[model samples]
Target chain A: MSHLTREALARLVDEMPDERERTHLESCAGCRAELAALTDQRQALATLPDLEPGPDAWPALRAQLRREGLVRERRLPGVAAARAAAAMVLFLAGGAAGYLARGPADPPPSLETPSRVAGGAAPVDPAVAAAAQGATTDVEASASEAFMVALDRYMAATDAPPADPAARLAALENIVLTTAEALHEAPTDPIISSYHLSALAQRNAVLRQLSGDGGPPVF
Target chain B: MTDDELVRRAKTGEEAALHALYRRYAPRVHAVVRRLAGDDALAEDWAQEAWLRAFRALPRFRGEAAFSTWLHRVAVNSALQGLRSRARHEVRETVLPDDQAGPPESPATLRLTLERAVASLPEGMRQVLVLHDVEGFTHEEIGEMLGIAAGTSKSQLFKARAKMRESLGSREMATEGKAYVASDA
Candidate 1:
């Protein structure tokens, strides 16, 4: 009876003691008293009252849960919207930085003509052309690349101006527009000189074409 | 509506079904949580949170157990989880003025002292107490619910009851009974 332990007392309180255990407990006066204590404990815990909720808590929790969205699900629109706004600002900032770096006046054009060789005009590097196209983030760099392309295309065209003044004028117009674009990108750049020169030459070619020069001379 | 139909409608985001389920089980959940924490406000918060959790998890309902049983499980679980969080209103630093709720010696104390005591018990013991005694889960059911041996469940129950006696008995839980120390033979 004195040997009956707490586990045994606990088992009896929960009513799970085996027949042998029960027989031992029956003979033990101490075990029976302990069992009564545990029974009383269980009874007290059973009677605790219900906790009613307050009014202000529901709306806050509902909005938070829905907006948080569980990890397994897609994020709520509120979060996504904020991220999108942030991305737009960064992209515009890049463009603004490029504009600021190029500053106020068009730079003068470079005199670095294609080094003439024996066989034919040197081939413009394709990599240089690609670099020019992607230079939108750096206004000066993009403008320089555009100038190179326009120069290369003009050099490759036949020297003689067409008899139709309109055809000649159109070519001059393209040069003028390309020059304006370059100047806008690097207002104070030296390269603007070459662009201005190209525009002047094309204007001369247009006057020749209109004067019944009888189509551009072959080659 | 039946649990199945309500669950299906809730899956489609029917506000009515969610409110219905809340009305049906909130009292029982509130009652169980109140017993576990002893704080009316915390119990209510957890009860509502349990419903919110149920709404979120409703899409996964495979109908394996009765809906009410699952809800009670979530409610108890939510209370236990709140208890485990440690940061959720740790024992108040300031004492409230004693009015009608009485002193710690009285069960009607304005500040519920039971929450801290229940939160103080070890996870295993406190959890079992919440399940069997207050939540009314049978030993067999708790065994199946928690995946422990039935004998293990009974032992845990006894140990938890003994611990609760110590925790609550400090003042508020003290009752007219001989103190019995739970021992493992």
Candidate 2:
């Protein structure tokens, strides 16, 4: 008795087979089972879902095709996104290749660019310098000083463990006091004045955040 | 216009006639395209493209086949290219776009459940099966579309049916196969 392979049994099921294959299907129980399975399969296939995509499917298609336009022209809108995508691909590829090509043994120091325009002190104004060696406007000097002090304190805090809630509140109090003094001293300069106001707002918000309940100012 | 007249006007660059022809056979063409491409969107694109091809090369058409037959041939050719590309791409790509993720039903109503199962077949098998079973193309006509011998189409069809049967065996599988084709009829 010849055993029917799955393929052979499958072929035999759909087709009007020659006398031999038909006879084989009937006589071989194994083939018979295979045949029944195939028959059941055909029946099941007949029950498959209707796959007629309707008109609503067109837009997604148009968009995908436009996206895939690797060649098709007249750029289909979203130019910025396209540029961004291409740029991102370029950046990743360049970065990955660079990292891979270079040895991991020596890592370069991270680079940070401080913006001079944003409020870093320019060369000091001579008249202000005559009055106070560090004075541009007292606000500018103080904001700059405040910024540096904040930086130093933050750096120190990182080295030492951060102070507890009470100590943190005390530190915030000093920031507001210094900001208020700078504001009063440098009333002429808007930049220092804005920074001073922001500092006060920040201290106030922190006070609120620290105090779970509403009450008078502490310290 | 009658199909013959439409083909004639379509051949003469009568866009209206061609569009009319498309409107007339769009459903059937859409069905064939969807079934062949296995991606509804791609199939629709192929269908529109097929009509455009037919429209563009209308002059070259020499009445070698019936208008619908010729259009179907163009459609099948356009569809097969898309299918081949998708097959090639699926091999290269790890992720599939959601629309291309699987088959969806076309606008046309489906008959037997087996049709969708049959639809999930490889393009070669699906083409032969649709040509033979649904559209009533003889093994010979299918052979022409596929450029294979008549006997080859029949065997592929046989193979297609069996493969479909095998895929249907697992009860755990639910809507595991996908197929969509539009219809004009």
Candidate 3:
């Protein structure tokens, strides 16, 4: 008789063969060896190790969950108190600066004037500084410290309000370039893609604002 | 904490509990999703979506099954749904590269070769093969998931095994030829 067909051998990997095929297997060395190989293959496949997804899986998923409101930030008990304390410090310092900058008779500068009033003595660009601070709080809480630091720099570069629009435009251009580079590492990341789009929109707005055109706000 | 406690907290929207569950199950979830997708590029998204669905469905979980079992079923279903959607939208094919030229010298190498072989199988055969042999789902269970008959699942499995054998043979990863013993019988 002939050796069993490959189909027969494959089936025999899991199912028992009929009497004729069993007799054939008893005598046929070739078919038995092939059957053993098939069995081994099955065992190998079943034992394959579980794989972890990309290293950034949690951060990406966390960002998505946060976006969908499926999960909320879980902060330790003291975090809210710390944030409140920081806010109070800022308030007191603002009061001190307003008192020092204007005569005591003058009403505190309108909220609009704070940016300009503080501009002269500001250690950092106020808008950039605030966004850099918020980048940690507003962005993914699970993101690595290095990523947050890098994003802080990116936000500062993209948000700085230097007197020269061209310089600001250059900064926006840098944001676009760097965000694009980040996207190469994580092409489907919503957060990074949003940053890229924001930078592009900001670049267009800056160009339009320079040409005295009305469009997306300069900020 | 027990999965029950974690599930309770996660249902209440406690992010730390959710994180803990993810840490516990992500590797297993990713493995199943990756095999189902047969593509690394799509696996991550599908795994993430599986977790999203699980989180969304936690409140309705009646605790009829183990948390890992429920999560596994969720991942399988999520990946199957994703594959079906992709099939409706596009006709994509996975072209496996030429097999490596030498006999695999290590168990790790053989495992890698087997993984590639499975990933490269035709969609139907690969799915049935993975769900049945690899994931240890019975044909009845696979039939329910794939909307096919159990007999059809078996037929596809046999075909998948034969094809997988040929794949391994081509890679020289199959058993030593003709070292004859019915003892293996």
Candidate 4:
């Protein structure tokens, strides 16, 4: 038998050999060896294990999703309302604390020319600083409130004991910690805000699942 | 739930359904990205990008193919785009010459050797070999994904396999030599 062409061998490797080439393989020792080697190579290639992302991969991807707005940032009206209420409460608490800490006649600490603005020694307008501080406080409060409400709702919704109470608690704790961290680093970033909100919502869903009211944990 | 059901919910912006889909397919997607990018950091970025792109494009996913297939294609595209962009700015790293000359000792060792060889292949050849041989994409599909003709894809695959065979052959010899030296000692 004539020697098989390299093209023919390549075709055989690709599983596209013609009828005549298929017949050639039966009687040809050299071609058979070549074919076997190729098959082995292909098999070795196929058996390469799929690589796994790090265990924290889902949280990273979830953050990306929130940044992209693929997942809803604002899940529930109640959650939002609770966040707002929480922000208001935090503002009031902070204001009262400031008032009590200051002496009765300390002149209310000059609203017009208080120190420490970014990049310069220029005094910030009291009104602008108050607004900025209020916004920051609101964001922090919203994140905190959202998490608490979600946790409270989840606790109320579940009837039976959780299947894995430790894991459930760990997940809740993680959400709280991650939200707190995000708020501390980038309190005003919408992406961080959305991520904070989503984490709470995800925890609520898990709680619902544990309580038998929801379907499954998102992760 | 089936991917179809999950996809439907994901289209409506359901976070749980999207998470379910991600959980189901992320390993496969990460594997493709890792093989294509040949660097863990780049692979992670590419995998994340692929998922984001998939979700953004979800509404247009008409379900013509299996979700896995569609997602794989998306990953391939994502990797290819990153490669193209990187190619434009980054200097190509030189792949070390293959010097070993014997058969591989075992299947497991051969697999590890082959992975190293594949990672060292030139970007174009590596992409063709991976898509064709490892991922089981057809020359036509690879051509479409890489924006090359089918014949070009075939040519690249052939060159890639030849290089892999040479590299693996050398590594096999090196492994045997090491075994012999250890035994003699």
Candidate 5:
């Protein structure tokens, strides 16, 4: 009997041979050995494990989405929103106080040294935490979390008594508003631009002090 | 939700649905692209690009085929396009050196040897071998994806298997020789 060709064996490994080919294979030792080897090779190929992409894959994709305008830039969701609203209120109130404290021709009060807030960390929202965990971009997530922590600490600090309370409050409010605006425009930017956090914390410290809800200063 | 539902929602610009779909199929998509690209770095990029293209084209995906099948085709196309582009700058080179021409070290290591050998294959033959032998794509399907005649796909698979056999056979002999030396010692 004529021997089976390698092509025939290759096809046989992928599919069952026809009756004629099976009968020939039943009697052909060399063909059987070739078929066995090909089968083994195919099995080996099939058993290879799937590989994991680097851990940064999802975040990289998310970054790409932001670049493509597919997704909005990520922010520290719940707490950041609350902090921003509080900052806005303090800013507006400070502005009103500063305006009222100044005479029409009085120069703006000299800027006070920024104060810091200190306290136990606020609980991160579970949903945001879960999202960060699933993101597998822990480094990026942790940096955002750290910034939020700093902002929280600043918000909690005791406010020092201002020599000019109205003007000091007004300046703090301006800083809060400006920082909030910058964060709103570029939430991811704060990861690289930490000054915004410092400014926000300073305003929070002043607001806390004005409200008589002071904690220790972080800086 | 069903894949169809997710695809529909994704088409309507629901990013959550798109992410769900990605999470579901990314492993399989990455596996296919990795085998096709034969490089981990290239596979990740190709897999991501494939998903991006799939997302951009989701509206046109008329649910005639299963989503996985369609995604596989997209990944294959992405990998092949990358290979073709890279081929322009790359000089063709042999996969094995003269000194390492022996058979695999042992039967236990045969699988690893075969995997390395497959990754070392020239692009055309490697695609055919992987699509047919590993990925279970039919010659007809491979031909459609690779834009060649089915006969050419078959011819390539045959040549690919022959080269693999030669390389593997040499390794097997070398392994046997190593055993003999060890036994002698």
Candidate 6:
């Protein structure tokens, strides 16, 4: 009798053979061995390890997520958020002190804002678009930090001590609203811009803390 | 946190929860799509797209199946859809390198050879083989996924295995094993 074809041997990896094939396999060591090899091959494929994508994989996917609005900007933890707020307040306070000491010369230079290119109006390179988006997020985050600092200093100067998280959250929210108005008028004023960012960052932190957003209790 | 809690939180647009899920399953997701895609470049794109689809469909995910199982289905569908779209645009074939040097002796070399051989299989066979054998999907499940009959899936799998046996230079290995078996007996 002819030996089993390779395809028949492969089928035997998963299926029972016909009587004729079973009889052949009973007497045929070569075909049985080949079937065993095929079975081993299938097992090997199944045993293949899960592959890790490149290190930049997450970042690339995150960028896509951001573009698609699936994931929001990551939130800093409570301590980090508080520390960041304090650092911003100190930096802006120093700058404000210097500005006061210098008696406030002519208005500060206009910050460079990337012009928003209208879709279909021009062919914008993807890299440039992504860079612009990142820059905008950075600018917004900085403006938020500046606002929080300005608001905190304003509250401190006014002797309005926030008694609890709810009170502080309310105060931050109020300041954020006022700062937003101030920003609308003097969009480029360093002091107003700083106040806007400070309010935003503080409000965000308070909201995050209240929501128990994977941060420590305080922010 | 449990996957259910994460899935619930993720449905509410929680970035941290979404990130937690991604970190847990990215490797598995990447593996399935990579095998289905059979090209590293296409695999990355398909895997990313699969996550996008999964996240987008999060709100509709009822807890009937395990999160991993649902996510796996999403990944497989994404890769298949991508392959179909590419097929509409062009027809490309990968020419597998000749293994004229004989069976690789080292396990690592053999593994590399096996992977290359799988990647070089015809697209239909590769998809069925990957879904049924590698990913452990049942033939019926694969039939539903690929929009093919279970018999067709079985046929494709058998053919894929036979082709892989040839491509992996396994005939020589089997012969060697047979010799050892005879000697031992």
Which has the better DockQ: candidate 3, or candidate 4?
Answer: 3
Q: TM-scores across all candidates?
A: 0.44, 0.43, 0.61, 0.56, 0.54, 0.61
| Residue B24 in model 4: lDDT | 91
**Model-by-model lDDT, in order?**
0.53, 0.52, 0.68, 0.63, 0.61, 0.67
Off by over 4 Å in 1: A1-3, A16-31, A65-219, B1-11, B30-49, B59-65, B76-117, B138-152, B166-185
Per-residue error at B102 for model 2, in Å? 18
**How many backbone clashes can be found in candidate 1?**
17
- lDDT tens digits by residue: candidate 6, B1-185: 99999999888776789889999999999999988888887888899899999999998999999999999999999999999998887655554355623456545555566678889899999999999889999999989988999999989988888777776652343222331111100
Model 5, span B114-183: residue lDDT tens: 6667877778999999898778888898899888999999889977876676556533322322211111
> Judged by lDDT against the true structure, how good is candidate 4?
0.63
| DockQ of the candidate models in sequence | 0.18, 0.08, 0.29, 0.24, 0.19, 0.28
Query: What is the overall TM-score of model 3 with all chains considered together?
Result: 0.61
lDDT of 1 at B4: 84
Order of candidate numbers by lDDT, starting with the best: 3, 6, 4, 5, 1, 2
Which candidate leads the pack in DockQ? 3
Worst 10 residues of 6 chain A by lDDT: A109-118
Per-residue alpha-carbon lDDT of model 1 for A38-115, expressed as tens digits? 676666556656554555545554565556552222121232222221222222222222222233243312223222
The TM-score, computed over Cα atoms with residue i paired to residue i, of candidate 1 is 0.44
lDDT of 2 by residue, A62-144 (tens): 44434543112222123222222222222222222223223244342121111231222533223223223332343343334
State the lDDT of candidate 2 residue by residue for B42-139, as single tens digits: 76678767756666667777887888788877877887767666776652212223444334332222233344565567767887876665566788
* Candidate with the larger TM-score of 2 and 5: 5
After the best TM-score superposition of candidate 2, give how far the Cα of residue A187 lies from its true spot, in angstroms: 65
| Candidate 4 structure quality by residue, lDDT tens digits, B1-185 | 99999999899887889989988998899988878887667888888889889999999999999999999989989988989888978734433234532344664454456667788888898999888888988888898888999999988887776666655552332232232111100
User: What is candidate 2's TM-score for chain B alone?
Assistant: 0.67
Better of 4 and 6 by lDDT: 6
Better of 1 and 5 by lDDT: 5
